[model samples]
Target: MSNSYFQSDLLSEFDRLHQQVASLFGGFPYSVRSDRYGAFPQLNVGSTDDTVEIVAFVPGVQADQLNVSIDKGVLTISGERAPAFGKDEGDESRRYRQERFTGAFRRIIELPAAADPDKVSARYVNGCLTISVGKAEASKPRAITVQ
Candidate 1:
C-alpha cells in the first residue's frame, strides 16, 4: 500500500513537469498558436457610441467571393482565398515556405448589446472586410432633460 502511494505521487509529479515542458514549447502541434481564436481570417471587434464595428484581415480575396450575414445577433463572415501561384507547364515555380492561408474560412462574431441586426452594412476595402452595425435608438445613451 505504501509503495502504491509513492508511485502515484511520482506519476503526478511527472505529469506536472510534462505540462510545463509543453507550455514552454508552445504546446503540441506547433502549427497552432495558443493566442489565436480560430483558423483563417483574424478579426478585430469594437463598438462605438452608436455602432459596432468588425474588421477582418483577408487578403487576396474579392468582394464578390465574400459573404456577410447577421442572424440572431451573430454576424458570420465566409470567404475563400485562392493561391497566388498559377499552374505553369513550361516554367516551374519553386516554393520554400508559405504561411498564408489559401482556402475557405468562416468566422462568426457576436454582436454587442446595442447592435441592431436590421441596421447593418458591410464593405470590402483594400485587404480588409469592414462590418458596421448601428445601435437601436433606445440603446444609445441619451441626456436626461432637466426641468
Candidate 2:
C-alpha cells in the first residue's frame, strides 16, 4: 500500500526549493574536475548491465563547445561554460567574489570492464549531458530456464 503522508505537498515544495538553491549555486560541493590543465563541468558516473551512464551538468555552455568521446575505456567530457551576460570587449579588469564557473573544463572517468566505447551514444538537453556506453555482447548475462 502507498503511504499517503509521503505525498504531502509541503515536502514537495521543500524539495523544489532545495533544488533551486543547488542549481543557482552550481550544484553541490562546487568542485571542478581537472586532469592537468583546465577544468570541466561537474559530472556523475555510473553504469548498468546494458550500458554505462554519465550525466554532466554544464549550464551556460553551448553544445558545439562540448566534446564527448570514449577511448580505451576512458570517457572524457570537455567543454567551456562561457561567462554569462556575454563578457565581451575586454573592458579593463574588475573582480568580485565570482563563484560562477567560466572558461573551459573537462572531466574524465574510466568505465567498467564490460563497457564498449564503440557502441556509445550521447545526448544533450537543457544544459544537461547524458552519455550511455553499451555493454559488450559477451558481457551480457543470459537467462537460464529450469527444465
Candidate 3:
C-alpha cells in the first residue's frame, strides 16, 4: 500500500541523517539539538526580575574568539572552535579518521521587546558564555502603592 511505501522511504531518510551526523561528531554528543542539523551547543536560557540570562556551552573554544550581539531584539551567538590540536606541528591531512567540528557556527534567538541591549552584560567562564540583558524600565514589573 502507499502508506507502507511512504513509511519505508521516511525510515531510509532517517538512516541517512544519522550517518551524516555521526560523521560530523564522529558520534553523538551527550546532548543534542533535535531541530538543528549538526550538534547545537548545550544551553540554558532564563529570566529574572531584572534581566534575561543566557548560558551557552562551548568547550574547546577560546573565550576571546566568541562573539555575542543583540540587534532588533534578536540575539546572535557565533564563534569558531579550532581543532583540539592544530596541524603544522606535523603532517596535516592524510589522517585515517577526522572529527570534532572546526570552523564557524552561529545560533540566533529572538528576544522580547523588553530586552535592553544597551544595558547588556556578558562574561565567559568555565567554557560557558553567559549573557544578561536587562529589561526596559517600563516593561519590568513594579509594585503600585495604595493611596
Name the lDDT value of residue 11 in candidate 3: 78
Task: Note the residue pairs that clash in candidate 1.
Answer: none
The sequence of per-residue lDDT tens digits that candidate 2 reaches over residues 54-130 is: 78888888889999977777777887776654446555457666778888776767677788878988888998998
Better of 1 and 2 by lDDT: 1
The lDDT values for all models are 0.75, 0.72, 0.76
Best by TM-score: 1
- The reply for model 1, stretches above 4 Å from the true place, is 1-35, 86-94
Error of 1 at 110 (Å): 1.0
Q: Residue by residue across 1-147, what tens digits does model 3's lDDT show? A: 467766567877998988786667543222212334454465777889899888888888898889998788778888988765548446466666666777787777677778888988989998899999999999999999999
Q: Can you write out model 1's per-residue Cα lDDT over 48-140, one digit (the tens) per residue?
A: 888888888898999998999888777788989887773533446787887777878877666666778889988899989988899999999
Off by over 4 Å in 2: 1-39, 85-93
Error of 3 at 132 (Å): 0.4
Q: After superposition, how far is residue 102 of candidate 2 from its true place, in Å?
A: 0.7
Worst 10 residues of 1 by lDDT: 27-36
Ranked by TM-score, top first: 1, 3, 2
